[model samples]
Target: MRLPIVAGWPACTVMNCEADQAGYGEDKCVTHLSEGELGGWLSRLGPEAEIHLARTQLAKGTLDQIKGAVTGQDDVPQFGYLSLRRAEIEGGVDLCYSRFSKEVDLYGLKVSKYLDFEGVQVSGGLDANFIEAPQGVDFYRAKIGGSLNLEGSKVGEQVRVARCDIDGSFLLRGCQVSGNVECYEVKVSGPAYLSNMQVVGDISFRNSSFSDGVQFFYTETSGYFNVSDSEFSGFVEFEGLRIAHDLIWERASFRDDVTFDKADLSGLVQGSCLFYKGVNFIRTIFRSAVIIQACARRVDFWGARFEVGGTLLLRYAMVRMTGAILAGPTSLVAFNRNFVDIFGDPMDEFVIPHEDPNVKLLDMGSVNAGNLTLVDIDLTPCRFAGAFNLDQLRLEGEWNFGTPPSGRVGITPFTWAKRKIIEEERQWRALRSHPLVLRSGWGDPPDNPRDVPGVAALMTTYRQLRKGREDAKDEPGANDFYYGEMEMRRHNQSWGKGERWLLQFYWLLSGYGIRASRAFGWLIISMILTILLMMGFGLPQDSPKQEAAGTVPPGGGKVTFEIDKEDPRNPIGDRFTSKRFERALNVTLNSVVFHSSDQDLTTTGTYIEMASRFSEPVLLGLGILAIRGRLKRGS
Candidate 1:
C-alpha cells in the first residue's frame, strides 16, 4: 500500500501520534520550538502545527500528551532530514527502515522485525542484533562502515542484500535462516558465514566474495546447494552438512577440495574439484556412482561413494582416495583395487590428494562392470586372476604389433615367471634331500662291481644324521645311496613329493644289467671248469697256470684254486685251476692240498681251496650269465 504524499510530516519522538502529520501546510512547525520539542519535528512542521509524534521514536524521555492524539494507526511515523542520523535502538523489535530518505545514516539500531533500509546509506553503524525476523534486513544499497553487526539474532525469513556493497561479510553462522539467503551479485570484501544452522530453503551466494574463511558447519538442508561462484580468500569448509538433495559446486574456486568429507549428501553430485586442494570423502556413503568431474582441481575421496552406478572419469585431472577406503564409482574407475580400496595410492598419476575431495567414488569390490580390457597390456609386472571373459573385453594397442591381442598365445614364459620363485623354493629349499644312505647298488655284479670311492661320503653324512652306529639308512635303501651303506643303512628320509620319481628308475635297474652282468658271468663259468679239471685229471695241485687274473672297471677277471692228492678215492679232489683274462684284460686262479695240508683243509679242502681261488672268475662268469639271462627274458 502506497503512503500519502501530503506527507510533509515532521520526525517521530516521545510526544503525540499525529505530531508528524501536523505539518499539513505550515512554516510555523519549524519555527515554534518549545522546551520539550525535538529539532526534527520543528524542521518539517510549521509554527501553526499543534500535533507531536515523538513518543515512538525509540526515545528514552517521558512522553507528553499531544494536542490531537489517536491510537491504532497502521502508517509509519515520518523522519525529517537526517533525524535518524545518530539514533540508537540498542534492544527493540519490529523497527521499520522504509520511511527514511535514501543515503541517510542509520547506525547502531538493535532491531527485531523488518529493518528495511533498502537503497539508503547507513553512514553510521547499523546494529540488527537479537532480532525476531531473518528477512528483517533488506539493505538493497545500504553502505555500512562500523561493522554492521548482526552477531546473534533468530532469523525467520530471507536476508537479501542483492547488488549491495558489503565492505564486510554478511556473517550469519549460528543464525538460523528458515528461508533462502538470496544475495546474488553482492560485493562483499570479507568472507561469508551461513553455517552451523538449518536453512530449510536453498541458500545462494552466487557471485559473492569472501576474503576469509567461508564455512558452513553442521548445517541441515532439504533442497538444492548453497554455494557457487563464491570467492573465498581463506579455506571454505562445509564439513558436516546434512544435505537432503544434490550439492553442486561447478566451477567453484577454493584452495581446498570443496571439502565434504563427513557431509551426508543424498542426491546426484555432478561437479569437479579439478583444482581443489582436496575433497575428503573418507567415510561418506552415496546412493549412486554417478559423479561428474569436469576439469576438477583435485579430489580426495578417501571413503566416499555413489550408491547408484555411473562413470567417474578423472579425464585430464588428478585425484586421490587418500586413506582407509570403502567407496565405489557411480560409473567406473579403472584405477584398480588398491587405488580405491586401499586409498591414497602415492604412485598413481591421475589421482593425488589436492583439490577434489572424492565424494562419489564407490567400492564395488572387484570390477563388476562387464570386464576390464587387458589386450596389449603390460602383463609383465601385473598378475591378473579371476573369473573373466576376455572374448569381449578389448585392450588398446596397434594391430600391426607382433601378436594380436586375441591370437593364439603361448604362456610358457608367463606361467614360469609367475610361479618360478615358488617352484624353485620347492625344488631347492622345500625339497632338500638330506641323504641317509648315499649308496646302494642293488643288481650290481660282484666282478664288474659297484663304486667304492663314494662310501666315505655316504658314511659321514649317515653317521651324523642317524647318530646311530648300527647302519646308514637310505630312504629307499638302495638306488640312490652308497652300496656298502645300502646294505647297512636304515632310515626313511624320503618324505617329499619330488622323491616319487625314483620308483620308475628303481624297477628298470632291478634286473640283470647288460655289460657288467655278462662280464661277471663269463668269469664264473671258467672257474667251474678249472675246478673240475683238477678233480678229474689231477691237474697238478697248485697248477702253475691259474694265479694270474683279476679285476676290472673296464673288463677283466681273476680266479684261484686248491688241490689234494692222497687218498685213492680222492681222485685229485680239493684241487682247483681257473682263468678269465686276456693280457691285463685276462683273469686266472689255482690251488692245491697234499699230506702236509693244514687245519684249513681236508680231502674236501683241496676242492674248497680250489673253489675259493677260482671264486673271482666264478663270480665274473656268473655276472655274464646274469646279463644273458636278462637278454633271454627280453627276447
Candidate 2:
C-alpha cells in the first residue's frame, strides 16, 4: 500500500510507481532510478528538496547511497524532508550524525534489522509511529527540535534513547518493547507521554529531566522502572501504571505535583525523592513493602493499600496523612527502629538518621490493623474515632498524645487539669454547640463542627488505648487514657441518672481516683473541720470533783463514809480556752486513725467521735488509692 503524500507533492513519472517524485526536476522515484541516474539526481538535489520513498522496497546498499547523498561535507549536515512511510528495508538503517532540517516520516515502515539514529538532529520532527523493527531502535545522543512521535511501535530488542534531547513533546504510547527501554541522561523540553506501553524488560530513565509534564498511565513493565537522579519540573502522572518489579526513584526531584494514583506494583517502591509540592498515591496498591525517604511539602496516601506481606515505611519523611487507614498488619513508623513486615519477618535494615522529624500523624481514625506499631510518631493531632482492635495495637517510643487545654477562664478560679487525652475527645469538648462543651476558656471550637466525635465513640477509643497501654505494662500511660475514658463517661447524657451523679462526684472529689493531691487535700481539710466542731460543742465545761462526808454512829464503834459526784455538763463559759483546745486536738487526731482517746465527754462529744471515725478513714483511704493509681504497674 502506498502512503499518503502531502499537498503540493507530485507522484513519480515512472509507470506503475505510486511513490512521490524526488524534487528538483527528478521525475522518477528513488526505487525506479538507475545507479548512474540516481547519482546524477542526487548531485542535483538541494538542501530544501523533499524526497518521498513511500511504498518503495529499498534494496541492499540503496539506503547507504541515500544517506550519503543527503549528508553534507560541513560540520553539521542538514537534509530536507524525507519520507519512508510503508517502505520495506532489506537491511539495517544507520542515519547517525546527520541532521534532518524537516520532518522525517517513517510511519508503518518495516525494518529487517536495527534502525539507528545516534547523534542525529531533527529540526522539524521525527515521526516513526507504527514502525516495526525486529532488531531494535536507537536514538542515543540525538536531538529533536520538534516532537518525536513513536506511538504504537513494536521493537524486538531494546529501545535506547539515552543522552538524547527532545525540544517538543515525546510520545511512545501503545508501544511494545520486547527488551529494556533505556532513557538515561535524556531531557525532554515538552511533555512525555508513555501511556499504554508494555515492556518485557526494565525501563530506566536515570539522570533524566522533563521540563514539562509527564504521564505513564496504564503502562506495564515486566521488570523494574528506575528513574533515579531524575528531575521533573512540571506535573507528573503515573496513574494506573503497573510494574511487575520494583519502582525506584532514588534522589529524584519533582518541582511540581505528582501522582501515582491507582498504580499497582508487585515489588517495592523505595525512593528518597524530593517533591516541592504534593505527591498523591491515592488507591495505589503495593504487594511488597514501600520504603520512602522523601522530603515533600505534602505526600498523600489516601485509600492506598498494602498486601499481607507488605509494609508501609516512611523513614525521615515529613508527611501528613490525615484520615488515613492503617488496616491489616501495617506498621506506620516515624523514627528509626528495627521493625518487621506483616509476616513477622525482619525487614531490610534502614539507616535513617536519628533526628527528630517534625512529622505529624494527623488522623488515623480509620485504623483497624491487628498489629499496627507506631514508633515515635507525633499523634497529638490524630483522631481514632473509627478505629477497631486498637487494644491489640503496639505503640513504642515516645508517641505523643493530646492534652487538656490549660489556663483559667474569666471569673473562674481554677485551671484545667493537665492530663493526656485523645484528639477526638478534645475536639468534642471544643465544640461550641455541644451540651458539655468546655465553654470556660478551654480552646477554640473544632474546625469542622460536623467532625466532632460523639462521647460514646471517644469512650470506646479511650478504653481501647488504655487496654493497649496496660498490656504493654505501661501503667502511667494507661492511667492517662483511663482518665480520658472516665471524662467521656461522665459527659455522656445517655448514662443513668444515678451513675452520672456518681461519676460527677468521683471526678470532683479525686479526679476519678487518679489525683492524689486532690484526695489528700480533702483529707487534711476534713481533719481540721472535725477538730473545730469538737472544741465548739462536743467538750464538757469542766471535770466533775468528788467529795466525802463522815458520820458517828452509836457509841463511836465505826465510822461510815459516803461519796458523791456531779454528771459532766456542756461548756457553760470560757469554753474557748487553751485547755479546751488541747482536749479537742487529742480527740480529732485519734478519730482520724480510727483510734479512741479515753477522755471525759458529754453526749454530744460521744456522737462527734462516732461521725469522725466513719468519715476520716474513708478520705484517707481515697488519698492512698489515688497514690496507688499513679504508681501502679501492670501485672
Candidate 3:
C-alpha cells in the first residue's frame, strides 16, 4: 500500500520507510536524514551561494516520536529558517557549532533527552519559550542577535549557558530548572527576567554582565546561588527571593539600586562588591553570616533578622542610611571602619579617609537584640562631627571601641615626642585648607557647645552597656562602662553651670566615686604638702601668760623649766622649739588624721585643718568602697 518513489528526487534511504517521501537531493529523506546529510544540505545553502539555493524552502521537518532521527550536525551549518514547533523528539537535539541566519523557533517543543546548542550563533532570536526537556539544556558559547526567550520552560536537568552573548533580553521567567543553572561569563545586552523562577539546584552566574536590569523576584533556589564577579548596569532586584543555601555576590558591581526586601537568605557573602546606588535589605532574614564590603550611597537593613552561629561583618563599608536594625539575636555584629553620614547632604563626599569633613552619624535607635559582640568600631572620629545614637539598643558582650591597649613597653620619651610631632603635622596638613576645619572654632565659644545631644546619646549607650554587664555579673566590666557613663555626664553641659563644676570636682577628688586608689594617693600628697607648709611656717605658740612658769626648784643645771603648757589635752603643747621636723610631723598628723597632736597651729594651720577635715572623710569613704569592690579598681 506504500506510495511509489518520485523519479527526479532520490528515494528515502531510511530503513522501513513506508511513505514515498522525497529525499533532500541526497540519499536520506528529509524526515529521516542523518546528521552528516543535514550538514551537507546546510553547506549548499551558504551566504555566498546562489540566492535561490540559500532560500531553498525545505519541507517541515516533522520527525515526531522518531526513534533514531539525528538532530546534530558536525560542522557549523548555515540555516535559513528552522521551525521545530510542536515537535516531539525522542533523541536529544545537538546543534553544536551551527549558525542560523534567520529565526529558529522551538516553541512548544518537547525533547526527551538533553538539548545541546553549544557554540551556535543565531542571527535572529531564539524562541524556546514553553519548551519541555526532561533532560538538560546547554547553550554554552552561543551568540544570539535577539532575545533568548525561555519563559515558562521546564528543564529536568541542568541548564548551562556559560560564555553566551545575548544581544536582547534573556527571559526565563516562571521557568523551573530541577538541576543547576550556570551562566558564567555570559553577557546580556538587555534585561534578564528571572522573576518567579524556581531552581532546585545551584544557580551560578559568575563573571556575567547585564547591561539592563535583572530581577530574581519571588524566585526560589534550594541550592547555593552565586553571582560573583558580575556587573549589573541597571537595578538588580531580589525582592521576595528565598535561597536555602549560600548566597554569594563577591566582587560584583551594581551601578544602580539593588534590593533584597523581604528575602530569606542563607549564608550571604557580598564582600568586595561595589554598589553605586542604594541597597535595600528591609525585612530580610539571614540564617548565616552576612559579610558585606562596599561604599554605597545608602544601605537600609530595617527590620532584618540575623540568626545565630554567624557574624554580621560590614568591614570598611560607608553607608549613608541610618543604622541598620538587627532584630533577632546575633552572635557578633561588627562594623569595622564603617563610615556613616546620617545628617550631612546626600551629595557630600562620604568615602573613608575623607568622611571626617561631614557629620558621620550612626543612629542605632531601633535595635532590640542582646548578647551581641560589637568589635573593632571607633565612634570617636565620627563623634567629633556628629552623634552615635544608641538609644534603646541593648548589647551584652565584649565592647571593643577599636582603641589599642595603652601600656606598651620599650617606648622612650624621645620616640613618643617624635611620633606626636609626626601625627600633628599629618593632621595639620590634612585639615589646614579645609573650610569646615577653618570654621570649627570661629563662632563657637571657648566652652563646648551646651545644647548638643551627642553627649546624652553617648551616656545612654554607656548606661545600657553598663546595665547589661551588671546583669551578666561582670562587675569589673560593668564598672568600666559605668565610668564611661559618668564621664559623659561630667561633660554634659545641660547640667546647671554650677552642677557641671561640681561634677568635675567630684572626678578630680575621687574619679566619680570609682577611683579609690586615686583618692588614697591624693590623701598621701595632701599630707605631704601640709607637712611642708607647717615646717616652713611654725605652728602658733600660746601667749606667754598662758604657758606654765619656769620652775627652777631642784637640780638646777641650766634651769630646765617647762616652757610649754602641761594641760591634759596638750601634753606637747604649742611651744617655740628648734625641732622643726617633729613640729611639722605633729601638726600634719593633727590635720590629716584628725588626732589631738601636741601642737596648736596658726591661722594658716587652722585653714589647712578645716580643708583636710572635709577631704579626709571623702577619701576614706572612697577607699572603703574600693576595698568592698563597689567601685572600679584603678579606674
Best by lDDT: 2
Model 2: per-residue Cα lDDT over 1-635, one tens digit each? 12233666677887887877766667777778888888898787655556688777888788777666666657444577788888888988888887887888898888899899999988877888898988999999999988887889999789899899999888888999999988999999989988999999998989999999999999999999999789899999999999999998877778899998999988887655666667887778877766655655556776777664344455444454433455456666663543343455543333233534445666555656454777677778776766678898788777887777577644567667788877777767677785542554546778797888778888888898899988888888888899889988888854568889889888877888888887778778877877777787788888777878889987777888889777778888777788888999899889889999887778888898889888777777788887887788878
- TM-score of every model versus the real structure: 0.41, 0.87, 0.60
Cα deviation of 349, candidate 1, in Å: 19
Tens-digit per-residue lDDT, 1-635, candidate 1: 01112234455332433233224343233223354443444344421223322112443321111211211143333232232222333233322332332122232333344556565444333444444453456666656542344544566567666766666555566656677656666666666566776677776666666666667777676666745555555677777877777776544556544666577777766444334354555556565444544444445555454455445544323344323222332332332322221233222224343432222322112222233222222221111111122122233331011111222224322111111111111112211132312111111222312312132333343232222211322222221212222222222224354433343222223221223433443445544554454344432333232234433545545544445334323324433333212111111243211122232223453565555455554455445544443344211
Q: Model 1: residues >4 Å from true position, as ranges? A: 1-113, 122-127, 146-148, 270-276, 285-290, 315-317, 322-329, 332-635
What does each candidate score in C-alpha RMSD? 23.5, 5.2, 12.4
**lDDT, residue 66, model 3:** 21
Cα TM-score of candidate 2:
0.87
Measured on C-alpha atoms, candidate 2 has an lDDT of 0.78
> Global CA lDDT of candidate 3, please?
0.60
Supply every candidate's count of residue pairs whose N, Cα or C atoms clash at under 3 angstroms: 131, 0, 0
What TM-score does prediction 1 earn?
Answer: 0.41
